[model samples]
Target chain A: MAIIEVNGISKSFGSTQAVRNVSFDVSRGRIFGLLGPNGAGKTTAIRIINHIIIPDSGSVTINGIEAGPLTQRMIGYMPEERGLYKKMKVGEQLIYLARLKGMDYEDAKKATKYWLDRFEAAGWYNKTVGELSKGMSQKVQFIATIAHDPDIYIFDEPFSGLDPINSEMLKEIVLELKDRDKTILFSTHRMEQVEQMCDDICLFNNGRAVLKGDLREIKRSFGKNTINLEFQGNAGFLDELENVRINNRSTNFAEIRVLNGESMQGILKTAMEHTEIYKFERIEPSLTEIFISTVGEDNINPKELG
Target chain B: MNLRQILLVAKREYLTKVRTKAFILATVLIPLGMIAFIGVGVAFAVWESDSEHRIGIVDETGRIFPRLQSVNEQRYVDVSAASPDSLRQMVVGEHIDGYVTLGEKNISSNANPEFVYGGSGGLGLQTSIRSDLREAIREERLQRAGVSEEVKNIYDSQIGLDTRKLTAEGEETEDDTGFLTIIGVVMGVIIFISLFGYGGLLTRSVIEEKTNRIIEVIASSVKPVELLLGKMAGVGALGITQLAIWILAFMGLSAAAAPVAGLLMQDQLADASRLSDQTDEAVSNFDPAVLEIPSIDPLLIVYFVIFFILGYLIYSSLFAAIGAAVDSETDTQQFMAPIMVPIMIAYFIMLRAMESPDGSIAVIGSLIPFFSPIVMITRIAISEVPFWQIGTSLVLMTATFAGTIWLSAKIYSVGILSYGKSAGFRELLKWIRER
Candidate 1:
């Protein structure tokens, strides 16, 4: 069953329509990725689901109830632009947020302690947020997001400021939550993480959902015409290829996409002539390529997608 | 609509703010500082009045020397013999406080007698010396004209007008308009300090939450109105706590000060009471109660609290709205001016109208809803005001309060979510017009 469902929701701020006829769903125990460039209605759609902003039209339902204060209690949301009181201590802030999420003081205290220790930050409980390092505060922010034990969780760009180790830690925790059968939805501009983490995705662009489906099916629908190449030679032949685009490029490797009616062998022939090919294989297109081909170059945010 | 959530928010706000070091320091220090200031002033006055002076005389005209001896201030000053040239040396050697030199010339000439003093004399000392010289001159002229001392003494007494005020009901008392003006000033100052202190706190608190972005998380769980109200209630309760502490401290200081005052000012107290007793006898129906700067009327205290709460609510809501509209404290200046002008107008009008509390300007000013919160309380303090006027003022203000909160909540709902450039009035108006 769909744990949450959104149907034809539209929202506008003044004359700017932030979300237009956006619809998607997250099923039980599945991870839903909301993929978009910046200002592509992803945050707006998430805010509508959290009931922070009222939609101009249509509806959102969480566990069969309409989106509102009740649904808000059942969902833990960490916004893309995260903020916590700089002067407030880690312990007080966590407990305050927990209490707002409907936990009693005693329960909030207990949960705060449990999460602080789990995050290996029990010693930081009394320290003011301002005193913490950026990553440490992000740790506190993530704890605040999940300490209340909500049935569903929504995180917008949760890994933006995190280091690789902490990002990996967040990924593990998110997967752990899925193991406990909690529905999760997150928005991000990072395509690799979405491929690794999301069971389903709703790709947004220009305030509309341009593509969406189960990750496996979406990738399967785009036939195999891309090459993941790792070679130990000059990449000069990359300029000679026709009807293909090179991405994720490095001196030793590149992700090459073959356009329609263009054979992967033809690109391999050009690449072999210029250098030694250590490894080359015809493979299904990555979500990044699918995203690029579907949304188009003009739609991708250079700041985020580049 | 969740009262539990609202109260939780209120409790958190109150505890965090009141626990700050600045709050504790301000609450205890301001009142103690005021009392000490008043104490220093009283001590200076007493010390000045008690010190005696020893003055030397160098009257070149022997005709005036003997007449100066019988001067009334001779009891307070020891008038001694001295040479005209040595007068400065006398004062410099500490043998005399000062000396008056009357050169051998006409009394009405360029060489009018000069009185020079040594030591740091108070500002009023010169006026005393000048008046004393003029009095002696008058006495000398009167005696030369052969006028009786008894007649001259009677003519010297300056009798002021005995004025009183009468109500329409024929009840009359001594005019105390000056007393009323003092009350109005005190009341205005209290209102101004309170609204600025507490209302500014509310604004800063809102902006802090907005800037912190915690407001978004909090708002998801509670309505914007609840958040706004929760903050106002919390800060207001904290203000009341601080006010209560100050009042208790003031009462304790006043109680302790009375005995110390009696010990330090025993002579002055006795003289003041004797004068009051004499004045009591002179008036036909004099009551001892009128002598009292009436103890703070409990009714006046009640009025003060009501007006303070109402005034704070109005301004605090307006400030909170501004806080939501702007991203920073500096940006609030544009919106802040509009609200401040009305408060300033109310205060100035309160001060100006205090000259005639029952005048048409005061009466109308107290009835205008925005001004009523400050002006009406002032009018009540001065003289007997009608029940109908207070009722009318409260009704008008209560309606305005409701309207202000409603409008402010609308703006707050939209403004808190809006980040970046400071909003224009048109944007705020659009927010207000939105559902």
Candidate 2:
């Protein structure tokens, strides 16, 4: 069953329409990746789901209840521009945030300690956030978001400030939550994390969802025409190839996407004559390719939308 | 809005703010600094006002020397034989406060010869010396003019105005209007300072939350109005706490001040007339209590608190709104100018209120919402205002602030999320008008 149903929700700031007819749902025990390029209304949709900004039309519901203070309490929301009181100690700040979500003081403290320990940040609990390193503070902010143990978690670009190791740790925690049957929604431009972790995905471009489905189903529908090629010689022949869109071209590497009615073997025959073909194979499209193709093909510049 | 959420927000605000170094310093420093200063000042005053000193006379001519030294032997300051150089040495050595030098007699000159002295607070010495010398010269001159002592007394009698004020109840108070103005102005200034001091704190706080993105996170969990009220109440409670500390400190100091005052003034206060510039012989004949500190009504203070809360609510909401509307503290200056005008006008009205507490201008000013917080307090201080007028002022100010809270919250909710560009007046009006 879907825990959150955001139906035909639209939002605008003044005359600028930020989100247009955006609709998506996240089933229970799943991590739904809110995929979008920059300024593509991902944050707006998340905010609407969390009820930070009232939508101009439609509605959002969590477990059949409309979005409001009660629904908000059921969701742990970490904004893109995350913040904590700089002068406040890590433990105190986390507990305060938890208490705001209706946790009792004792439970909040316990949850804060558990999360701090889980993140291996126990020694830094008494230190003020300003005294922490960037990655460490990011950990603290993440801990703050989930410390209350809400029914749903919404993170806007949770991995943006994290280092590779911290990002890996965050991905583990997100997936671990899904294993425990918690619904998770996170918005990001980084596609690799979503590809590894998301059970479902929605791609937003220019304030509208251009593609969305179950992760396996979306990939299955893309067919096997995409090629990841690694060669030992010149990539000059890639420019002359027909019915093939070269996504990236370098002397030793090329990522090629074949248009419909084009055969992969036709490109392999040409690549074989021009360069020593090291590796060429049909594969499913990556979340990155899907994002880029969908977003780029729409001729939608999110910068202009912003 | 849930009361628990509001209280939770308020609690955090109070705890965080009270922990700040600035808040602690301001709360402790202002009152302690004043009390310490006044305490040290009293001790210094006691030392400076110590008893009598002797003066030296340098008479180059032996003839004038005997006559100058011929004055009374017993006086606060007595003349002793010493030259100008010797007197300078004595003054430096603490042997004498100062010395006076008489020039060589002016032959054929009618004006008295110039004499110079180096000392402070020798006015009593100056008066007696001048009178004695002039009397001696006058006896010589009067003998020539055949003028009588009775004629001299007739010309010397100085008459001054004796003023009094009768209140509506036919009770009289000494017309020490200056004291009333001082008390009234002090009360008004205290309120004005706290109103802005704490109000500006709330504004800066809003800007801080917005800039840090803390407001956005919290805004999800609570209404903007609840957040604003929580901040205002929390900060207001802290302000009251600090004020209470000051009041207690002041009262404690006052209790200790009386005995210290007695010990310090032991030599001076015995002669009750020494409190005034009028001679003991002169004022001792009349009532000793010609000047008074003037009493203030206890209820006036209660009115001050009521008006203060109302004024603080209005200004702080504006400050908070400005904080939301702008990006930083630098942007607050232009917005603050409009807020400051009413306060400035109220201050001016306070000045005028002292002069005519019952005048049309003062009456109307006290009735207006903007000026009532400041001017009305002064009006209450200057006279016993009717209960109905105070009630009306209170109701009007309360209603005005209620409306201001609703309006400012609208601007605050919108401004908190906006950045980069500023919200102009048209934008602000739209925020107020927007659903």
DockQ, all models: 0.62, 0.59
User: What interface Cα RMSD is found for model 2?
Assistant: 1.1
- Write the residue-wise lDDT of candidate 2 on B200-231 in tens digits: 88888888887777777887788788888888
- For model 2, chain A alone compared with the true chain A gives a TM-score of 0.94
Clashing pairs in 1: none
Deviation from native of the Cα of residue A252 in model 2, angstroms: 2.1
Question: Please, what are the lDDT tens digits per residue for candidate 2 over residues A268-287?
Answer: 99889999988998888877
| Runs of candidate 2 exceeding 4 Å displacement | A292-298, A302-306, B31-180, B267-296
Q: Write the per-residue lDDT of candidate 1 for residues A35-119, one digit (tens) a residue.
A: 9788889989998999988899999999999998889899988887678989888999899989988999999999999999998
Task: Assign candidate 2 its CAPRI class.
Answer: medium
lDDT for residue B241 in candidate 1, whole number 0-100: 91
